[model samples]
Target: MSSHEKHDVETSSGHDIAPATSTASNGLALKPTALERERAEQLARLPDPDAGKSPEERAEIDRKLMWKVDLWLIPWLSLLYLLSFLDRTNIGNARLAGMENDLHMFGTDYNLSLTIFFISYALFEPLTNTLLKRLTPRIFFTGIIVAWGIIMTLMGLCHNFAGLLAARFFLGIAEAGLFPGVNYYLSCWYKGSELGARSAIFFSAAALAGSFGGLLAAAISKMDKIGGVAGWQWIFIIEGLATVFVGLFCWWMVFDWPETARFLSEDDKIRLQRRIIQDRQGHAATDFDKKYIYEALKDWKTYGYMVIYMGCLCPLYAFSLFLPTIIAAIGYSGTTAQLLTVPPYAVAALATVTVGFIADRTRWRGYCNIAVVLVGIVGFSMLLGSGDPHVQYAGTFLGAFGIYPTISNSLSWASNNIEGSLKRAVAIGMIVGWGNLNGVVSSNIYISTQKPRYLTGHGVVLAYQVLFLLGGTIFMHFALKAENKKRLSGARDNMNDGLTDEQKLVRGDNRPDFIYTT
Candidate 1:
């Protein structure tokens, strides 16, 4: 017998067969690899975990289990982010409600306050996410919320520009974990395909917070000098206290990880564990390891994701922080401008959720982002093109509607494409943290002197949206497509399939079977 034939026949009954030189000819179209054949046979022989149960019985169990998890998880998680974003963006609302007047802030004091928050926020994110890995989610997440809530309350008491800066800086430190932490946590529970929609649900709360903050500020501004406090003070105190209350309640409500969830039955837990493993195609890396962080840092894709994220965030954060101010500059001021901020955010909240659902369903994250960015480009163009305030206001609607969805889409895309817990954690932290540094650039762009038209600010944002952002998105899309093609056409088995479970966790996205989700 030929040596190759002898090698294959000798190992035909086992897994470690010699590699095939080419397909066995019998006119077949595709030749199965030894690993693929072995896997298929093993699956055929193994009993299903739910083998004895009827299809109806299994379906009913799955329905109840999913409903329980969904109900207990999404609402409170969304609420946590809602509060986090409210505390972050309410400063914009407070500015018009006499915060600047009461603190004697002028020129760039307001800009400095906004810029300083993002600096501390960006600096602390990676460390905070790493801490979430070491500490239990329950302890760490609730603690940060309480801490930031306290800082939010203290903002009400800041009597000077320095005091306000101090409050904002600490608030950033406290809030550093939330965005990345939540993204990591969701990946642990949901399939990669599910992340886009789930992230949308989480992010939509931030948009809603902007709307709520606007309406709340308009109402609270009327409470000026109520008791011994200014309306701006009331905004911080009321919102902060509400956040603290919710944070305390989350201690009881939040689920840490599926394996640790007390509410799920043993069968449901096993099923969920199996489903998550299958969803990742055995590539999900759950173990805590420093190597994963190194892998993320070394990967060129990490920086690519970061650049795209920064492009999106520059405009998103700037718009969120300055929408009220921008509206006021467009000839509406006081309560009317605050009220005007409401509809754009409301529209954005809905548009973001819808796009998220579609992105998840279609698995078209890059395309969706490009589409939204295009919409934002149009919005910015209209804002720059128009001499009319009403037209500029309409442009705000398009900008909010577009950019908010892009943030959720891009975020979910990163979470979906990355594998390994630590790698994902590091990637998310770097992308969000570094991306937010653009907020410093954005904060300074809308100079007080250029108010009303702010031609320079609009032009700069337009350039970023059209140039750097569009370029990053297109490059990533093609890069991921090329990588997927290589993997699909290659003959190798999953690189870590022969390794021990512990080694498999370490291998992460390096596995040959793993395909990048674009």
Candidate 2:
């Protein structure tokens, strides 16, 4: 049986939309404001573009627009995430460069340092994303990114374990909200059908950054003997400075939403927004209150996704934090280990794009996530079970590739299953937030005790992967059973609304039949 079941999740609870007043069918929630209603009604009254251009011509234009937005947006967002990910994980590279010798961090203390970052990172996730939504991503995100970059750079000043721990804590605090915020921001621009591919593209930057960091560390570590600073210090100084500069570039370059992007004319903004409403079957977001979060939280799918993502992300971050260490154990010098780290990330970049393409072509994310895990099973098993160093390195590719889509599909799954603006926002934020707590487990997964072989860590990874597989399977099975409530409750009658895309903006995406996606 197919493990990823999607039902007609068509309503946003606590966001009551009287469908009788709705002018759209996108299953979005209705806003109470009279001005919003007037706008929807006015848009409904406009002449249809199909009234003039042929369907083929319209599609061509749409394609061009999507390409243009994707071409510019993917690189910029990817760059931002790339720097963030690199900064977060470069400590692994730092460790390989004899930083432990300089800082005297030999024990579980190193793991504690990594774990602290996630502690701060997990606590503030929803708060950060909420700020992004409330304040607009442009101003809010740039501030956080710059703060983290500066913190990451100052890490070079650390002389001992205590100093490193403080830097790591600040780094985590500064970086906490970015991933989830980017995920939420993407939801506004891309619809369900196209989001997974773009998500993969955004993540590919992170994948490439890992590879780039390794290469960079190899070159910079060689500089350690030259300067009074250690190799690890050079990694922090160069990479941290690079991140600050890139953050400024991203501030200038990133275009947040269709409504406000400078590149889009006023008409184009409206057109893009209208198109999105059309694609979603109505308005994607209608501002609702706190009751909305409570209602969305009631769904079992929310918790199920939380568990699966937790399992998946645990191993993902573990590997990200320890790849260079793992590579060094393969008997290479620090420089060679850095070079060796590139292949796994390179493979991950390929795997992400390939899996994303396949998922989109088939419109199948659930199984695609499953497939990714299978690769992890193979990869990590080799890393743990194989005695041969050459064979163990091959496992890195599998591990990284498998973990990449866990985020992609989980977020895509949220976008697909959840309906209405407030519910969608809360659900996505919570999922991303909860999933990150898995990073806590990951931060400590590969301890100094398990070093050399890392068998215990690999064993933990396999167990978590199995847990994820079972969770994904169960979520699909019963989620559909839950969706049946809408048909039974007579909610569909209240959900019959007539809203063209423009009509939906003012009249609202009033519907009640939606259940959370399984």
Candidate 3:
């Protein structure tokens, strides 16, 4: 092959090439540009932790490091998330404990209250996530938890609808940072391939919270008329106080970043950073940049993931917030309904973690996302079409199982594909922040008048599930695959030709060397 043809072949193979002398198309000898030389040097300096280690040695090192990280990180984060979720959704339990009657909530008042929380939540998420880099996870997470916990305690003291609405709105603002913030934080520590299972383990806490919330509410409701407060008030006061304690404890427990984590040795930190850099195929810059935020906003893939997230999240919020009411309508008493919510959430927690492990092992997040969504579709279909109470109850288990896992898969997939730390942070915030607006839709659809057979709510959730399958999951899968194919075929080789090394790093996932996870 001619020299030009060889260069083409090398570029097509995704190698960086900056020849000192090369014949141009006009047969002129061209010199390497300064930027090209600089980029080449930067790539040469990129660390490889496995440089001299055997595969077995590397595996052993990884095993020990991961166990240490998981032991210190996942459980504490999961515990905090569990408390966050419990505090957020316990209002559903509160309603069953006669909060509505006590507060004199009229028709649509309760739904409006739920809608207001998500409005604040959706609005604040992106801003909060951006601040996370500045504040650090340790301070950011602890501050938000304490803020929300206080708001939740105030919620118990609400005597009227206005007080309830005020508390809920502030609660939204405070809690908005936790979910997306944790997702971004995890990306800092884990490679793209290892992120799914860890994310699943963290998120499964929401499912566990569901189970715990049900049981806690059931037992806490028995504190009726204690201190002259209603049972519903006790649920909030007790759970909220517990949350405050956990938040305060997080100050001592939460690690800021892998680099700063005191739990890891110097060698472990260096090795971990090298592994992450290698996974990105470049440096993982953490500095804040307006351009990174703009890139995330402009990227079509960010919006695509947001839509997919909404499809899953709508059903998730609807199911969690209304499960007690739905069960009560199916011949169970109020307390019994609260207790019944536990089993579905227990099953869901197990399924979520299991599927997360499978997705990581097989590296098939898209397929797993699609499969679980399909399960949820079958579940909602059963609920909509069947009149038998047994079938409808069984459907709840399927629904919980399917919906909880999809959030983990989708989050990991989005984070896996994005390359820069700040850029991924912005993208996660946008996806989760905007996606949560569906909570408004969920709150309204299950109107009290539609109690026994909430056909409208079931039907809407079912449609969103279908959209998740078709529009979000399938579209993203094919689009990412096609992009990868183009990159592999050298179509993007010249796309960054004129850019400086700094500019190219800022291009993030759009960089030709970066591959999207489908």
Candidate 4:
């Protein structure tokens, strides 16, 4: 027998099955890809712990392990994220508490402050996510949290626009890592199908932060004259100090990667790793590689997801930053406005988690995205078409519920479709980075001049929702479906016929066996 035939015989006998390669049309033997070789070695080194267990036994074990992971992992991450979001968006509440007047911020200084935060935020996200792999989640997360918390506290001391700008810029840099970093971090622990709900549970903290921030701001604003601090100053100082406390505590609470987690047993670690590997179709390398970064940059789908994220984030930031102001415009002011912001966000938090659960169970993230964006569109239209304050206030509830859920859905969709650690990290970072760059647009569009109806702001947000509906959710649904169909048809089976293993792994999501989640 020829060498190719001998290799095939070895594969059939399960001796060297890792490289699972096909012959060229010309009958030439193809070399096993690097990923295949690595996967084989990993499988040998860490055989599945559940391999000998019956299906019912494995199911029970998996259920228990998932609960353990959820109990240990999700709540801590959610708390960190909540504090991060509270620090970042509390500026909106501070504005209501007289930040603009106290700082003598002119026509666009307030907008500029918000815009500058996002500029640094957008620029640093990819960098921070890259560091997350190298530095480990514990160090990276805790360090950034401490840094941002300190900065947030100091923001309360800013006596001028320049001072506030500097604080916001640094705060942006410090807080930038948490959102995308957590997204990537969660991807490390959960399967694609499980990510939606997990991410939603994590992201619900933001909605909760909005709710809590409002109540906190309303309560804290009453401390306006205490210790010679303004209400806005108290808001920043109090919230910032609370964040610092959480950050210090996180040092003890945060776990590293699954294999290194202290809460899991040796068998649990093996089983968890095995399940994650199988979920990715066995692309399980965790080591950092330059090629993964390059591959992420080269993938068109990364940009596509970024566009979808843009649709979600633009309006998201706009609404979050301006919700208080919008409520004030709707015949409520000061504490009343702050308090009113609570219900919409509370409702949104509930809706976000609900949608996340549905997406996970249905495995239909794209469809869920469409459904939420439609709801947002209806809400935005009500705000635009009606002059009635009651109708407009009702719009906020719908807007919050609709927009908040899309992030988790779209993020899980992106995570589901992408394979590999570094590649997924970079892709998520870029998607979030580019998406958040729109905060500049979101900030400026809701100009003070466009108050009350703020037709331009409402119109722009509505347009973004439409784009999300048509260009993002609907387009990606069909596109991913077509890609999965092509893969199923086996047209791509020979695409890697002559490629090296490293090359095949670099192909990432384009690999023949990789099926996209639509």
Candidate 5:
């Protein structure tokens, strides 16, 4: 194969994407020719209606394309995430449905169990993501989902503390790669401008799962007479079956990577794929090196990012895993509690979509992060301040809405700031890994004493929101400062120096140039 042909992926019509070439002797790839580099850059910077793919004249074309892509991506993803999240979170619903009594968990044992899952999940996330380079993300991804799905179903069968812990630990292991892998894959398909909204659209599945889980539990609790199985058991069996089925289906549906997708036509592949690398102002990085990961760690921005993301697990877990219990305290039965839980997630899903679209249109991410966090604080504080069911329930919307930015902003920020090819790969992994470390802390916040009113739980969650908002500010501040630093550093210094972004893969991170979009 010619140099460019080596990188080529084919479309359905057997059309080939433009080939990329590398000059490096090392395993790392160097950028292609200057002209090829330029083409990649142009593609990246193309204004949305990006490249007029869906021009004003072709509204139907746009709709059809969106549907075609979403058809495969959305259902499978929604099902995948719904299952994982529902299983992880059903503990909350199950808690209210009588898990605490049957399991003999008291004080904070349940909360501790929830927190433990994240510990294993956070610790292994980076390791699993790096594995993607070697693993067929499709196979690798599906394997984990299927394993976890079975584990979730088995949670219903647990008779004691040990059994529950064993299930959660394996559940953590199987579900580890999911969030980061999908985030990385999405980055491959969509440009920075289009990603935020699409990301939200994808993530909203979790919220929907949250909504439906409540309803499922409500109905299941009514089936309390089935073989003496608790309502929580039904929650597990149903969601787990759905997860396993959807996971099997996802392998057939999801695009493995841009280069490997089965759907796009060759011309569309050529046109679509070529656009990203070229969009870089100039230069590309090639080489798969440990150094990229190191530099990202060295970069203080990683620390700043950790703030918003790291502290997130508490609020999210508290909301997802403990929500049913929390809502149940508002003086409702399991069914009504489940039904009420739906609104918060339903509202959250809507906000996720709306904010993503607006953020995409404006090309502003930090502002959106800040705005969402602020609204979330309102929701969290309401829970802290009131005991009235009406008031506390209303706060759920704000809380759910606040989290819309977790995926949208985090991944978008990484895509904007990360420059080199290997660096982009590694940086995104760390972003997810380090940030999720907070899940451990987030999980343990809900204890038995905190229940009914959960004064401590509410306080801790509110405090987490406060921390995340501060983290958001720091992220924007550092992002702006980095851009300023780059500006003062003066013009970039190589043939690849002025290369297009797509060409970046060839640049082998020698600290190749990148602009941090504030």
Candidate 6:
């Protein structure tokens, strides 16, 4: 028998099977290309990896697979994020526990420390995200988490302002990868609609940590003088140790790609991969190309998302990092102010998850974003208009509810609208990295000298809400609608008329088959 003929042999089941290469309609030999051959082999190896499965069966399989993915992945990522958030914002709690006097932070030193952390965070975030895919999610994420955890623990050892500043700067570098990396990783698994709620659940851990951190601080503050440590030191020591432990645990738990998930059957893995490809409509679904990075950089929507995200995060971070201080400034003092921070964060967590659920189900992300920002506008107006502590406290609740929802919405919105994995990676990273520069703005806006009302801070945040409402909500909604219309009108058919399949794949979102989601 010829080598090709031998390759076509079948089993005793009597099914007729052709060799890998066959004849085309014009009688030329039709051999599989490298990409096609790899895809075919991947499908063939997966147990029962057929699209002919019944809808009911497919649904059942997908449901089980999603549950498994969620179970294995979500808890660990959320826990790590919870700790990341706790460590990040715990400086406020530490301040309440006497870190300011211990380290002799004066004037704008505290503000500068916060500003420096964000500067390092913003500078490193995109670089870390670009490295994440290359390093693999499991190693990159766990390594950064461990690094930050160690930095956080060592914060307790810092006896001077310079020591705290250095620790915070490095901590920012270590933490830059996590939040965006998790978002990029989720885009690998979930569809556009599924992303919002999942992102919310993941992001909500920050608020939960804030509330939990308050209670933890209250308890830990009483531990002053144990092992020659101050109460603030204990707060960092205990929380940082907990974060390190979670990071170590997650090292073995995180799955970088769906196909590599050990908990999944071969058939389940194939289906998981197929579902995301279908969801994204073949826009950079499975491969990485350097051109996608350049394309994303040139895309205007990337920066638009970044600006809107900045608007949202400015208020969110200000609120998270200074709620205790804000409360203390409003006449509450000692642990009472620390305890008061819990409610706003708790309320914010509830608001965040609820809106995320609604946005996913309704698919009204653009409108949802606008509506939430308006709620914050009202909150900020109230804060600016009132002098009553009770009224100000109510405004805090409103502001918390408004800002927290936007984190998930804006994240999922960017992830939803951008196509192609590498493009999305750069886009998400840029959005997050650039947006967080607002942290520097936020850190400075609430100056100690401007306390009691901080009219400038409230006014600045309110103006941002209006800007996002106009640019991010109204403009993006109409722009996406116009683009989708242009694509549907078949106006770009001439551009790809002579292109091969491989060339078309290279077009990414510019492909006629691609439609931008609003």
Query: Cα deviation in Å at residue 334, candidate 5?
Result: 2.0
Error of 3 at 343 (Å): 0.9
What local lDDT does model 4 show for residue 370? Answer: 88
TM-score sort, best first? 4, 3, 6, 1, 2, 5
True-structure lDDT of candidate 4: 0.82
List per-candidate RMSD values in Å. Answer: 7.7, 6.9, 6.6, 6.0, 6.9, 7.4
lDDT of 4 by residue, 123-164 (tens): 998888768766778899989999898999999999999999
- For model 5, how does the per-residue alpha-carbon lDDT over 31-113 read when each residue is reduced to its tens digit? 67553554455455433343445456455654565566666676666667767787888888887778778888877788678
Query: Per model, how many backbone clashes are there?
Result: 0, 14, 0, 2, 28, 0
Q: 234 in model 6: Cα distance from truth in Å?
A: 1.1
Model 6 lDDT-worst window of ten: 6-15
Q: Clash pairs of candidate 1?
A: none
> How high is each candidate's TM-score?
0.88, 0.85, 0.89, 0.91, 0.83, 0.89
RMSD of 5: 6.9
lDDT of 4 at 260: 76
RMSD of 6: 7.4
> Whose TM-score is greatest here?
4
In the range 1-518, model 3's lDDT, one tens digit per residue, is 22111111011111122253456779997775433453344336545556799999999999999899889989999999999999989999999899999999989898999999999999998887668766788889889998888999989999999999999999999999999888777766776677788889999999999999999999999999999999999999999999998999888898776667899988787666545444444334445668877888889889899989999889999999989888888889777889999999999999999999998887677899888988888888988988789999999999998799999988888877765566777788888887898899998999888878999999999999997644799999999899989998889889888888778867767876567777
lDDT of 6 by residue, 1-518 (tens): 22211111111011122244557769898875433453455446445575688989878878888998888878777888888899999999998889999999899888898898999999999887668867788889879988999999999999999999999999999999889888877766776668888889889999999899999999999999988999999999898888888888766788767777788887777777655534434333333466777778988888888878888888878888888888888898778878899998898888888889988887778888888877888888888899999989999988888898899888887777775666777788888888888899889888888889988888888877788643677788788778878888987656677878766655556656456667
State each model's CA lDDT, in order.
0.78, 0.72, 0.82, 0.82, 0.68, 0.79
lDDT of 2: 0.72
